[model samples]
Target: VESILDKENFTLEELLDEEEIIQECKALNKLVLLDAHYVLNSLMFSLRDRAQVEQLLRYIVEEPSEDDDSKRTFKFPFIACEIFTCEIDVILKTLIEDEEFMNLLFSFLEPNRSHSALLAGYFSKTHQEVLRQLVDLIGITSIMEVLVRLVGADDHVYPNFLDVMQWLADSNLLEMIVDKLNPSCPPEVHGNAAETLCAITRNAPSALATKLSSPSFVARIFGHALEDSHSKYGLVHSLSVCISLLDPKRSAIASPLMHYFRNQHMYEPPIPVNPETINAMLPKLGDLLMLLNVSSDEKILPTTYGELRPPLGKHRLKIVEFIAVLLRTGNEAAEKELVGSGTIQRVLDLFFEYPYNNALHHHVESIILSCLESKNDAILDHLLHKCDLIGRFLQTEKQPILSGDNNLPTLPAAGKHAPRAGNIGHITRISNKLVQLGSSNSCIQAYLQ
Candidate 1:
């Protein structure tokens, strides 16, 4: 984007290295280093020539030939956009207050233009962090105001910093954000995109649900989640976005993947997922879960001689967590699938397989608890009679510390069940969940005891 300014003109990098940016920005004396002074003086001098930033903005909006798309046209504006990111008070203050600057910036985002993609780049990993740091430096509300002042110009758009919400509601912005949540993108891109999408959802619980709940979107995201070779963060971020779509009001707060439903103070009704989407993804996700159940092993950490990673199905933790979210949201289709496909039974096996992965414990606990609380007789019947819920727990409780013992229905000669730390609480929660069922059958009472 900045080829024009690389050598022919000058680069801020040539003057001030990254580590010295803050110090240079604060050097009120301005006469610090010769290189810095020279570069700043030259850049300031050009600010008078055709109004540098304004002209660059215009250049950015121009369409380039197909072959020329890779270079040249984008040079100056991207350079200027990046420069604006530096803590340069004079340029930043002027740009923020200038109506023309804001308009020019927004103009870069006009429909059917390359500028949209260019501007979207700012939300990538690095820029996302910069925005966050800016918020920390100047609170959220002020940052929101500052964003409008710095980026938008139309009276309608700049009046409120929720300008994004307007765009999200009016046009294809939300779709673009959703598109970025795929495995093809970098993990950080997916993470930042998911965060942005979640914020938009919180602002409108059901307004955009139909768009997000589309089968294609669900399949793409879930497909990425099951991808064995993609970066873990990318998959987890996609799952996070998926959960937000399913349960818009579950927990508006963006927490860790495993902690998505925790830290809640108020009850929020779960949004209904599109039945078509649920049906489409259930079999695919269940198949993947089952594959991981068999393909993955529970070998302890390896030494320098072997693979240093956890067993193959490590991401089962994320998949299981995702399923836990679905169950917790009372997704009827999901419950039926878990029971009918024997997925819930496998998930319980997965829980014991990775005893050392305490996070998996919580996910497993959430899943079982959600099921017991669901009160769906078929699912409950499968768990109690066919799945042998009580027998499984009792077997796990009594299984000798046998090595190579992975899950229920199998116990090797010597092993340690990692769930021993919380077995008592686990049993209590099962009993509590059963009590919530409000059944007074003698067998249920005995099982509780």
Candidate 2:
């Protein structure tokens, strides 16, 4: 097969002849699905005219009817992809330089259109230089949405896709992505827009730092999405972006990005609480606990069989884990914000709610250690007094342990009983910290005794 394929390479004359095959296929209303790669490769370089390119693009975009025998006609885009991967420079120059071809190609992205992902995947695989030219012709936002869809829909990683993402960052296209994340846009659009922003920031942090250096730019992009009441998934995307920007490794923009997240609350009803909104908001520790304890109804609870699931269930645990990360920064401002936001109490509530959650226990322990390590009186006061930290710990520790000897159904060992061991260790450590903070306090003395 390799030898046959090697011998079958089309020469210029053979390519010219294959053009007649394209005409023959079209005249008979038949698709050359089987020989698409050969047909496209043969015709690609030879057909450089705008009219010719548009015709090829139309073949890719046009949908055959359900009743038609040529339903697989949409596979033309895959052939186009093969051609793109092989003769990218020649094909890209022809497509990017011609507005009609570019427009026709982009038309495949409309939501109602079939085979949009095929078109997008092919477009994402173009050369970086060609990608820049393509974006210039089709506009960055439109192209970004296409790329975002391609990335989100498939698990496969394409190097060309990463190159295009880097190009967008280098070209300063973050603002274009921000513009697409408005509340008026569809949820899918918002999701893709946010995903694109995240991809750029995650893959190319230096480029993101350049954008984040501008307060207005950060506010315009990340801040705007946060403040848009109707931006559901976009808000989640923005929060994820914030988490990336705030990484201590990328401290260049961390301080300013933290400031934006801390103060921006123009949208209401302030923090989001319900499952749908929680899934959308992608809350961090400060955001999670503050919003959770706002009202009794909004509090986080343990997962129960037959109960309606909270949107942030497992994701919530991940957010709680971030508390330790924020504290690790020793960003005094962030620590103060967490203490002031009533998050410590909420953290305790979450710990108690999911007693089997060993991961949550570890995170709460980190928060306790950080506070003890900081010796910040404000944090101490909130934990000890306002949040009644010791009392709750004592109450949880005193709760009766269920056992099989009573002939009662034991709470499943893998689920409900998993954290009981961790709970004892957590209580002992907190008691030790309280003793060190002040043996003089009656509550501390009593808990220790």
Candidate 3:
């Protein structure tokens, strides 16, 4: 029987016709559908007629049987049938849509507290694949209700049906999880539910956008994560990443995104990197900064690509427009504090120590130059080495601009043929104009000195 089943293209009718021979042959191969893993593996291994196999699986799955004895333990056969069958669509559609069958099926989800964990842990590609097919075939609203109910189980320690949502995205299922996982709920519930949704939507930005665009829903979701209730950094960070991915555009939505971040949190200042958490958390932070329009220097700085080009570097420039928005809003306090306390210096040090060969040193220098030019002295005050660093940066950066010199562009700086102004005000005005009008980057460096 096993040999026949193993053949590349055998048919189900062939197996059934030789039932007597199969029964006898079973002594050697030992039909293991009476047991679980063996049963699933057997089903996975078999490649007989799909329709007939599905029929056999349905019979095993749907047949009423007692559960107290090994002889009565029908779990293995049911699971095997689930694995071997390709038309799970017919099974799930009928099972999930039929109220009686769905209740019976859902009952199996818990499988009694004693056996639930071990049995649930038995979730294989077969079970998830079946669930996905079922979700697709069933009504979205109905499936969503079932999902919310399942997740709401206080005893529901592990995340199930997560892939269902992913499959839904693939099939254009409205990320219905967003609605079911209510944000107005308690903090723990909200966080767990949000994590579940994020797990589904992490790489699916359009689906993420679907959730965030719903104003009330998006606001409550983020508000709880940031937990205005208690300034937790991790939740705030997660919320930031979510908001970034959501790409909230409206003033109403974007306002809350920034306001919560700008609002000071009281959590114990960030802890030293736990190798496990750093990799997971850093990328999310980078994405969030991109959405929040927070400067790279202000929050997390770019780490990829070589440094020694523009002040911000190549990696940072791609997102420079977003960072510039932070300056326009005058929300640099957090950034200032971050830089003042050594974070900025550490980032710069890292860049110089690991320089890249093709680094464009001056364009980045131009950006930083532009940024410093627009800022008031107060913002610049916190940036230590403000003058000297600019000087060093200019020395490295000015070569290209100098090379492009056309009649030196008539620099505003005073030289051998310069005119003297009559009053202090005039001199100050001329000095200010010179700073702005210092044509070449090199000339600007000379004027600053």
Q: Which candidate tops TM-score?
A: 1
Residue 214, candidate 3: Cα error in Å is 29
lDDT of each: 0.54, 0.49, 0.36
The C-alpha TM-scores of every prediction are: 0.58, 0.46, 0.28
The candidates, ranked best first by TM-score, are: 1, 2, 3
Q: Poorest 10 consecutive residues of model 2 by lDDT?
A: 266-275
Please identify model 1 stretches exceeding 4 Å from their true place: 1-166, 169-172, 206-210, 227-231, 249-280, 294-299, 302-314, 399-422, 435-449
lDDT of 2 by residue, 144-253 (tens): 54554333222233323443334445553555556666656666666556555555444433434445434455555544444653344555555445544444233224
By TM-score, the better pick of 2 and 3 is 2
Highest lDDT among the candidates is held by which one?
A: 1
Task: Rank candidates, lDDT, best first.
Answer: 1, 2, 3
How many clashes (backbone atoms < 3 Å, residues ≥3 apart in a chain or on different chains) does model 1 have?
A: 5
What TM-score, to 2 decimals, does candidate 3 have? 0.28
Q: Where is model 2 more than 4 Å wrong at Cα? A: 1-170, 178-205, 220-225, 228-232, 248-290, 293-324, 400-449
lDDT at 14, model 2:
34
Q: Give the per-residue lDDT of model 1 (tens digit) for 1-449.
A: 12323467654433322344344434423554535565445444444243654554454455556676433445544544455555454554454446576555555445545544664664232233333333332323443355423322223553334443344344444455566655677655666666655554444433344555678767776776666544667667777767676665543544433352452233334446666766767757665556545434445554222221345344556677678778876777778777777888887766654444456666677777676656476776676777787787677667624224233322332333322323445555665657755465454565555
